[model samples]
Target: MASFKDFNLSRKVQDAINDMGFEEPSPIQASCIPLVLEGKEVIGQAQTGTGKTAAFGVPIVERAGTDRRVQALVLTPTRELAIQVAGEFRKIAKHKRVRSLPIYGGQSIVHQIRALQQGVQIVIGTPGRVLDHIRRGTLKLNSVQMVVLDEADEMLDMGFIEDIESILKETPDDRQTLLFSATFPSEVRRLSARYMKKPEHVTVNRGEMTVPLTDQVYYKVLERSKLESLCRIVDSEEVSLGIIFCRTKRGVDELVEALLARGYLVDGLHGDLSQAQRDRVMKRFRTSDIELLVATDVAARGIDVDNVTHVINYDLPQDPESYVHRIGRTGRAGKKGLAISLATPREFKLLKQIERETGAKMEAREVPSLADVAERQAEVWRNRIIEAIQGGSLGHFRAILGNVIDEYDPVDVACAALKIASAGELEKREEEDYNFGDTGAKPGMVRFFINVGRNANISPSDLVRTISEEAGVPGQTIGKIDIFDRFTFVEVEQESAPFVYEALRKSRINGSRVNLEPAKPRARR
Candidate 1:
C-alpha cells in the first residue's frame, strides 16, 4: 500500500513518476526500489506484468548522472525486451534528461554507433548485440556503476549465459548487479554466485504463476475447427482489445489473415517483422486502432500494454512458462481479464501440463453456438437502446412515433419502429440460421469462389475492400476467407451472396478479369 512518494527519490524522479500516473508502487517495486536506490545488489524473483520494470528502471534513471557516460547497463533476452526496458527508462528519466538507448540486432549498428558517439548514460540491449558492441570497442563498460539482468532465466534458456558472463566481466567489479528471473533455476543461481556480491533475494507471487484477476478457460476443439471456434468466441464475447498467441510466425500470419478476412480489426507480430514494422503495429495496438493482435511467443516478449481485455492461446504453448507469459499479457494492474485457450484432443496433455505447473484450474468452456451469438448481440443492442432512451435524446423520434400511432394501432406502430431500429441485428440473426448448401459452410453464410488469390498478391484487406466497395456488401457481413494458390474462397451472408457475386463477376481485381460463382460442393469420402 506504500506510495512512490515515500521512496525519498529526487524531485525530478518524483515528477516523472507522477507524470506517468503512477500513484503507488507494486510489491516488487516497493521492495526492490529502495534497495536499488541504496546501491544494493538485489535479486528480484517475480513473473512478468508485475511492474518489475519500474522497480529497476526508476533507480537506474535516478542513480545515473547527467554526464551521460553509459553508467548503467541492462541486458535482456530479446530485442523486443531490450526496446521495452529502454523505453521504460526513458519515460522515468524524461524530466531528469538521462539518455537511455536500446541496442539490438535487426537494426543498423552504424546508427547505434552514431548515437553512442553523441553520449548515452544507460544502454539496454540483448546479450548478443551487447557482446558484439563490446568486442568492437563501441560499448565501454568501464564506467558502468550498475548492471541489470532482466528475465535472467529467459536469457539462460536462450543460451546467453556465456555472453552474459562476458558482459559482466567487462564491467567494473564494484558495480551493483541486479538479477531478476521468474524462476530460480540452477543456472541463475550459478550466475548470481559468480557475479553478484551477496545480493539480497526478494520474491513476490511465486506460488501462482498466473494472476488471480484473470478468468482462465479452455475449449476442446478440433484442429481444423479452431479458427471457427475462435471467431465464435470473439464474436460472442465482444472482445474489445485482445492478444492472440500463436505457436509460430506462420501460425500468427495465418490467424491474422483469417481474422482479417472476417472483417476483424487485427494485426500480426512475429520474429520476421522488421523493427519499424513491429513499432508501427505496437503503436496502433496501443492506440486502439487495432482490436486484436496475433503474435508468436518470442515476438510478444516485453509487451506491457494494459488495456487488453483478453489473451487467447490459438495454439497451446510448448511449455508451461510460455503459457503463463501468454496469459500474463492481460489482467494487469488489478483489472479483470479473460484468458482462453483452444486445444485439440491431441494437445490436451499440454493443457494439463500447464494446469499442473501453474496450479490454477482452467474451466472448460464449450464453443459458442449461433444462438448464443445472437443472444449476445441482442443484449448489446438492447443495452444501446436503453442508453439512448435514458439520455432523453429521442424526443424528436417520439413525436414522429406519436404521429404514426395516430394513423395506426399504437402497438403496431411501436412494433414497426422497433423493426426499423433493429433491422441490422434482425438480419444478422436470420442470416445465421440460413443454410447455404452441401458445401458444409457455417449456417447463415454462403461460400463463393473468386479468381484472384495469393498469386495475384491480393491480401485479405484488399478482398474485403473490393467486396464492400464494388459489391455493396458491408464488411462485417463477410465471413471467413481462404485464399489458395490460384483462387480464393469467401463466405458472405446468404442474403448478400447474390449481390456480391453479381457485382464482382464483371469486375477486375488487380487489373485482371475476375470470375465469381458459388463454390462447388466436394464429394464426401
Candidate 2:
C-alpha cells in the first residue's frame, strides 16, 4: 500500500498514526494491518522492531469498543514485554474509549484483580500470569473477540507453551487469532494450526543477516552523564559520517542540539520533519556536510550510506531487530564500522534479550576517562591536520600558522590552536552525576539497602509498586529484589539509582517509615 490511507482505517486511528510521525508503514504493518483489520486469523512471520505492534494494535483498538469486557487478549512471554505491549495498546487507543491493562508476575494480583473489575477492554500479559488469573477466576476470557500471540517463538522457548494452551482454550473458539514470530519451528506451526482458522500467512524476512563487517559494543553509563560520555566517545573515535539513534523524536532533537552546542557538526531526523525538510537533512548528510545524523528508528529506514563509520544507539532499542537495523546503517560497501550502544544497568535484561535474539555478542565497556579522551582527541586532531594539508593549498592558513609551523609539526600546531579555541568543553560537564558509590551492584547496577522487609509486613511487590509509582518509572526497570526480615536489598540500574533513592526514602510503606540508601558491596566470599 502506498499510504496508511490505503488501509482505510478509522479517522481516530489514522490521526494517532499521523501524530506518531509515521509517514509510511513498515512491511509487516502494511501486510498484516489490512487482514487483521478484516477480522481474519493471521500467521505473520516477521522479526520484532518491524512495527508489528502497531500493525496489530491499531486494528485491535479499532475493532474493540467501550464494552470494557476484555475484547482483546495479547499473550507475551515476559513481564517486560507485557508492559511494553500494553503500553503500545494504550498509546494507540489514546483517541478512543478503550482501556488496556498489563498483568504479569512480580506484581500485585489483588491490584490486577481490582483493575479488571473496573472494566478493561484489552488484557496483555505473560502466559503464566494469564493462566494464574484465569484459574483464580479473576479474569474472564469468554468475552474476548481477538487473541494475539506475540513473539510466538519466544513463548515456546520460555516453556510457556502449556500455559499458553490453557489460556487459549478459555477464549471463545470463534475469536480472531493473530500469531507473529521471527521463525516458525514445527511446534509453533502446530500451535497455530490447531488454534487459527485458515490463517493468512505473511513472512517478512530481514535484510542480509547482520553484516559481518560491523563491530558491535556497548558502554555502561549513568543517564545524566550519558551526554558527556557520548562526547568523549565521539572525540575518542574516528566517526567519519556517523548516525546516532535515539528512541524518540524528542531524544533525536535533544541529542542533535546537545552535540551541535558542543561544536559537533550534527543534524536531526524524525517523523516531525516535513518531506522537504527530511530531504534537505539527507542531502546534507550524504554530501558529508553533517558529520553525524541523530535520528529515530522510523526516520532512518531506507537510508543506505556506505561510509558511515559509526552507528551509536543513544538510547537502547526496544528490540533486537531495531538494534540490527540501526547498526546496519554503518558497515556498508565492504568498509568496517562500529556499532555502539549506551546502556543503563537497569536495561540488562533487554540487552541480554537482544543478544539472544540476534546471536550478536556485544562487549560491555566502561565510558572513557578524561585522560583517555584527551589521548584520542590528540590523535583525531593530528589526522584532521594531515587531511587538510593533503587536500588543500597552504595559502589559506599559512600566514597565521607559519610561525608555529617553524618549530612544531604543522599537525601539533594546529592541534594546540584548536584545543585553545574550544577550551576543552567536550571533556567537561562538572555538575553531571557520574557514579553510585560502592553499591555492591554489578558493573552497571546499583544495590540499595532498604529498611522494611518481611518484618515490616511488606512483600517485594509492595516495594516495586511504591518505587515504581512514586518515582514515576516503569516497574520492569526495577531489578532483582531481595527481601529480609527487617530490611531489603534491591538492585536497580545505575541510571535509576538516584531517582529511586530520593523518591522512596523516608516514605511510608505498609504504614512503617522507610530508609533507603546505596549499600557498600558485601565482602567477597
Candidate 3:
C-alpha cells in the first residue's frame, strides 16, 4: 500500500497519478515496480483492474531516455487494450514531454505511419498490427531498451502467440521485457522460457471479492438472438445506471448504435474515443445524465462508479477475473446491485469456469414474450395518469375537459376523455416498444419484482400482462407471483431479467410507476 511518492517516481509522473486520484499502489504495482526499475526481466501474475499498467509504466517512463528512437514498445492481444495502455503511458509521460503513439487495426494505417515518421519515443500496438508495421518497415525497434507484453495469456488465447514472438524478435537483444497476465498458462511459460532471461516471478493473489454486494445472474442466450434479448430485458427492468461489456471496441460501437435506435438514453466508450471524448462520456455517466454505458473491456477498466445498478455482459469476458471486475461496478457501500450476463452455447464453458472460480451460481433465464411488452407499456401509462391525478395540478385542462363532456353522452364521454389524456404519454412509449420488436426476444420467461402489489391496487395478472407486452416475455414462463403491501414479485428464468427489467422500467401500475430493482432474496410474502 505504498504511495507513488514512496516509489520515488519523477515529479511529473507523481503529479499525474495524484491528478488521476490514485493514492496507494495495488499489490502488483508494489511488488513489480521495484523489480522492473532494477532492469530485470519480470513475470507479473495479476488480474485485470489491478493497477499493473502503472507498475511497468513508471519505470519505462523513467528509464526510457528521450533520444526519440522508439525507446520502448508495448504489445497487447487486442487493439482496444493497446490503445488504453498507450493512453496510460502518455498521461505519465505528459510531465516529461515524451511522445507515445498507439497503433492498431481498424484505424488509418497511413496516419499511424505518419506519426511514426514524426518520431515517437514509445509505441503501443496489437501483435498483428505491430508485425504489419515491422514488415512494412514503418516501426524500427533498434533503439528499444524496454518491451512489455500486457495480458500475455490473452494473446495466447486469441492465437497471437506466434505474432508476439515475431514482434519480440525485432526488439534489441539487451532490452528489458515484462510480461503480465492473470494466469501464466503453459504457452506463456514456454514463451517466457524461450525469450526471457531467467525472469523474476511475481505473483499477487486476490484476497477477497470486492464485489460481494453485487447480485449476479446470467441468461442462456443464443449467439444470434442476444441483441433482441438484451433489449427486452432493458425495457422491462428499472435500472438507473448500467454498463454493457462487449469484448471488442467494434462490438461496443455497434451495440451503442442499436440501443440508441431503440430510444434508450445511452452512450459508447472504447479505445476509439479521443481523450476529450472519453472525459466527456465519463462525466455524463458519473453525473447520472446518461443511464446506460456500452464499453469494451479495456476501455471500461479504471472506471470506479459505485452507483451502477447493473452490469450486463453483451459478450462474455476472456477470463474469470474479468467477470469479477465487470460486476464490481455495482453493489457498493452496502447497497444492493446486479450483474446479468448473456451467454451463448460456445461460451458456456468459460461461463462455468467463472462460476467455479467465484463460487457463485448464475441462474439460467428465458426470453421475454411480446405480451409482456404491451402489458408493461400499459402500466407505464397507468402510473403517469395516476401521478397526474394525485398531484392535483390540472386546473387549465379541467375547463377543456368540461366542454368536451357537455358535447357527448356523459358516461361514454368520460371514458373517452380519460383515454385522450393518457394517449400522449402512452404513444411515445408505444412507438418505442414496437419499433424495437426485431430487437425483442423470442417466446420465453424470466423472474422479476414489482414495486407495487395488492395493497397498492395491483395483481398477478397485471404484473404478468405488463411484463409480457413490454419485454416480449410470455405469460406461460411467468411463474409464481407474490403480492405484498408495497411490492409484488414474479418468478421467471434468469435469462429474461434484462428484457423484463427494461419493460418494467417503462411500464407503470396504479398511479405510481413501479420501481422494479432486482429483488432482495425473494419478494415479501
Candidate 4:
C-alpha cells in the first residue's frame, strides 16, 4: 500500500509512520500485517532487514489490549535483536502508551525482574533468558495473545529449537503465532508444521542470488591482526562509504571506538542505542558525514544506502548464507561494490564453501601497508583542495593563507592547511581481556592449539571447547588448528596472543605440554 492510511491503522500510528519516512509498506509488511491483524497464524519467509519488525510490531501494537498483561511475546536469537524488537514495539505503540520490556542475558537480572513486575504489555527476549523468567514466574504468558518468533531460522541454527518448543508450550494454545525467517529451510517448515496452526504461508523471495556487481575478496590473517589490518585497508582504499560487519555488540562498539581513535570518520550501530541515537548515527552515515559504519549483522539490516563502496567482514559469518547477505549490502542497484572478509587458515575453508555456493571466485588481496594509508590520506586532501580551487572559493581565505605562506615556506604552509582540513578524530579503547596462550591457540585465529597430533591422539572439538571456555571466544572464531606430535598451533585473535601464550605456557593438551606459538604465514594454494 502507498501509505499506512490504506491499512486503516490508527491515526497516531499513521502519523508516526509518516514521521518515520515510511511512505509505503514493504512486501512482507503488506502481506503479513493483514493476516496478523486478522488474528491468523502466519509464517513469513523474508530476509532479516526486510522490515519484518515493523510488519509484526504494527499488528501487535494495534491488536494487543492496553491491559499491561504481557499480551504479546517476541522471541529473537540474539540479545541485541531482543533489545531492538522491543524498542521498535515501544515506538509504534508510543501514542498508545504500550509498555514493552526487553529481557536478555548479560544484563542485571534484578532489573529485568523489576521491569517484569511492572506488568509490560509486550515482552521481547532471547529464548534462554525468556525461559529463565518463565521458570522463575517472572514472566506469565497466560495472557499472551500473540507469539512472534523473529529470525526463527537463526534460533534454530543456534540449537534453540527445544527452547522454542518449551516456550511455545507455555503460551496460550490459541495464540496467534507468527514465525519469520530469511530462508525456509526444512527444519523451519518442520517446526511450523508442529507448532503453528495451519499458518498462512507468505514468502518474499530474496531471489536465491546475491548482488552480481559486488567484488568479493578475502585475506588470510591472524585473528589479532584483523582490526589493525582493517584500519590500514580502510585508510588506504578509495572507499567513500563502507560498512564493517562484526558478530556482536561489543565488537561494534569496540571497532567504532577504535576507528574513531585512528582518525577515521566512523560510527557504531547496534541494538543498544535508543531510537534518537540510531536516527542520529544513520543521518550522519547517509549524509556521508561518517565514512565507516560498524555494526552487528542484525542491526545493520534494512540499511539501504546506495553509495556503499565496501563491506568488510571483520568477523566471518556463522554460515555461507549469512556471507551472501553481509556482502549483498554493498553491491546494490547496479553499482560496483567491494566485499572483503578477514579469514584465518581454518575459516579459509568456510570462505571457499561460500564461494562454491555463490558460484563466484573471491580474489585474495594483500593487506595495505601504513605507507599506503598515508598516501590515501594525501590523495583525499588533494582532491578536496582541487575541488575547492575549481569552485573558486579562494577569494575569501586567500589573504589569510597568503600571510601564513609569507611567514613559512609555501609547501609547508600548504601541507599544514591540508592536514587541518582532512584530519579526522578516531576513537580507540583498551582491548578486552583475552589471552594469547589461554587456549594454546596460535595468535590471530579462533582455533585452540593442542599438543597431541597424529601420534598423541587429539581432535578439533576438544581444542575448540577448551580454548572457547578459557578465552571466552567462540568455537566459530577458532580457525585452522594444526596438530603436531611434539606441539600444535591454533589460530586466534592477535590480541589473544599474550593470553594464549601464558595460558598454554604450562598447560597440557592431550596429556602433554605443547609448544604453542603464532605460526608463520603461508601462501594461499
Best by lDDT: 1
- Candidate 4: C-alpha lDDT: 0.76
Flag regions of model 1 displaced more than 4 Å.
Answer: 207-209, 382-525
After superposition of all CA atoms, the RMSD between model 2 and the true structure is 17.8
lDDT of 3: 0.76
Q: What would the per-residue lDDT of candidate 2 be over residues 1-525, giving only the tens digit for each residue?
A: 789988888898888788776788877788899899888889987644456788899899988888879899999875656777887787888788899999987788999999999999999998888999999999999999999999888788668889988998999989999998877789999999888999999877544345667888988665666798899888788788999999899989888988888889999999798757887898899899999999987677546566999999889999886687678677765679899987654455577788888888888776787878876766666677679779988795788777778989977886677778657743444445646688777877889998778989888898888777665457877888999898899988876676676666667788899898888889999
**lDDT tens per residue, model 3, 191-270:** 99999998999876644343556677877665556787798777677789999999998888889998888777899998
Estimate the TM-score of every prediction.
Answer: 0.72, 0.48, 0.58, 0.60
Q: Best by TM-score, which number?
A: 1
Candidate 4's TM-score: 0.60
Clashes of each: 1, 1, 47, 35
Candidates ranked by TM-score, best first?
1, 4, 3, 2
**What RMSD, rounded to one decimal, does every model reach?**
13.8, 17.8, 14.5, 11.3
Off by over 4 Å in 4: 208-233, 236-310, 314-319, 328-376, 383-409, 416-525
Residue 254 shift from truth in candidate 4, angstroms? 14
Candidates in order have lDDT scores of 0.85, 0.82, 0.76, 0.76
